[model samples]
Target: MAYSSGGRLPFESASKLGHLNVIESEWVQSLLKDFETNDVDNADNYENDIWESFDPSSVQSLNHIWAADGSYVSVEENHKELAFVKTALMTVEQGKIAAIDKEYPHPLKLQEIMKDSALFHATVFPLRNLKSDKGNIYDTVRHVIYDSMRTDENGQYFETLKWLAYKKWDGQKNNSLSFECPHCSKVIETGIPYDQDTGICPHCHKEVLLTDMIGFHLDMNEENASDSVASHYMLIMEMLMLFTVIRLQWANKDTTLISDTLFIKDGPMTLNGQYSKLVPNIREFLNFAKNKERPIHIIGSEKSGSFFEYLSLSSRFVKPDPGIIKYAVLNHDYIRRVIQRAPDRGNPYGLRTNWGEKVFVYLDENTHMVLNMTTGGYDRSDAYPKSSDIIGLQRILATLPALVSRKYEGALYPIELVNGIASMSNYPSAKILQDFVRDAVH
Candidate 1:
């Protein structure tokens, strides 16, 4: 007897139809309702007054240049959580990997590093113990979740919170950092209450975590598990890299080496997550570098953004001759047009997320070369602010053409080098982690 297929033919098969409509045309039309487009010709409106013209020769020769990037991966997925999370930090100098830090199986390994390293200090507790209602020792866990959001791989490590608690951590001694109430934003004059997850905010009259008050936000969306972890890993690693650079800067204080070097990162100089409050600290670092006399230029250059995308499509921009570069000193008025926003808060008057002043640069008319640049030390406010020193902006603009990547269009070589070195390929990371664990067991 021939066995007949028991359920619904095992599976239903359908012929592949090319270019099938994934979204309803009506929905597409609805999305287009708020879609606004302006004539590309308008880009020329401020080209003359805003564009800073520079020749290729004006680019400065630097003694040293460095860039950094970080990567994270979930090694194994369990029923309700990732079985293992792996993270790696890479720093490159002059197209060479100068430093690297990685964590596997446990993030606490990172905390140990931070605790022992003279370059860093732990301002906040990596883990805390909570007492039950009866005032009995309840349980303890890692500080992996913040403001009800699950953090990514090895999130339990507390070194990530040091930036937020730096203002309170005493050097050489791991002391509790003073924090404001999350609800009130009021400074808790008496230090964080003992054995309590939350404290009463005097100003707002609400219960809030003292740690959350430090660069933590309830408005941040952390619903996507993978995305959330990746964000934390990136932020923590970026800050750590900055710390490394800062230590270098401090070590060479008596020498001119640090001053001659330029520190560049792949993305904006800004940090996100619970560590965002550290931005002011980064700004201070910039100022400190500048005050040392011969300042080393540090900047964050983006390869893509909505503004960059629009600038690419705009044909009205005046192109520079071969080996020359053209740059625009972006203002609020011009930015609003390029980045469309709701009538309420979309105006380009102030910085929403980015800490650097938005700059648009064309590497050359000879190629499809465009770059987005941001420098540190500028005050982040909502109002349209001009670079106090236009000459400084011009000097930075002049440095780009020399750093352009010969391999990729619209890419910077240093950033490309660092990114390539830092990025962890899926296969390599998996193999490395697996082999590492296997060796450990053996």
Candidate 2:
């Protein structure tokens, strides 16, 4: 059962498991009662002091702050030193502080901060002893006062522990969406809000579903907390990709940035075993891209899951005939190549060699084919087919000008021919080949 911010009670009254029933009904109620009592006491104190010390001017500013968990260093003789450094940014209004935000380095670092002796626990005694010489004067306070107020120590440790526990609870929860569409030659951005669906593209107008989008709640727990963060990160990446795509469409009209741009998911792109929810969402975005004739590129980190398998499965849904879409399992070596080559030329999207030659087309390069997946993928794949199989497909497509022309068949004859060649060479299932051919002809 879950509660919203508005304080609505969950419909399910009883927990299915007997052990949880006691914890949920009895133990939780007791804890809530205790919390309420403490709140009442705090409220009384606040009310009592409402006028005596409530000078608005003395309270310098109210700021929002965020903290990253911490880092660890192993010193000589097998000694480990845990150092927790939190980054705080102040958003000030005129002269007052407005907001501060913090994020944990990684979920695991929270646990490390709690257990380590060198950081959190070491400052308690000194903090407790700190006091101002002139207690009532705020300006007279020294560094010790700031240190005591700024550092959490025990609270940080406990908060980290609580976050880890909440993460555990979140892991059991599931959420995601999915869709289907033809493969386009351009890069497509899916998961667009329905309100923003209409487009000026010559091929289609009003291309997205207004009501198809849904919000999902994820369970939080210790074991899968990291996984949850990774999933959220992927969602953010997808959003960023959409932003980049939109920027290309209306703002920049650049193809090279879209083509050469690489998005890195902190973990593998695989959706784990929870496919029913996640896959459909991914499919929906891909389908939208196909309709828009856009190529979508994604890469996952070393910690990525079965993303390759998922991509392989998703590839089947893409009509091979259009030859608009292709995906690859990019490992660390591939990512390293992109990073290394980014520095040499005046532009990042120039001629850079990875496993083979790769031309980084900027956002402006080849504007006509910038968002077209079939043409762009073919062009890029032709330049840098990561594997021999992809290279062979490109070679076959390159031969199509001799067999066909740009007359009645559309400018996509080359793409269709390439798909046919790929199907013939790869010998995929009959259903897949037939689908590919159908997509190509249509």
Error of 1 at 380 (Å): 7.3
Give a tens-digit lDDT track for model 1, residues 212-324: 54433333222223334445545455545544444434444345655556566666555554455555554444455456554555566666676656566552456556766
Runs of candidate 2 with Cα error greater than 4 angstroms are 1-193, 196-252, 255-257, 272-278, 284-294, 303-442
Model 2 TM-score (2 dp): 0.22
Question: Which pairs clash in the backbone of model 1?
Answer: 152-229, 349-382, 350-382
What lDDT score goes with residue 279 in model 1?
Answer: 58
Summarize candidate 2's per-residue lDDT along 8-127 as a digit string, tens digits. 222232234434555457667555444333232233322111011111222222121111111112122233221111111111121111111112123354223222111111111111
Best by lDDT: 1
Clash count list over all predictions: 3, 47
TM-score of each: 0.57, 0.22
Our model 1 lands, by Cα RMSD against the true structure, at: 13.8
Judged by lDDT against the true structure, how good is candidate 1?
Answer: 0.44
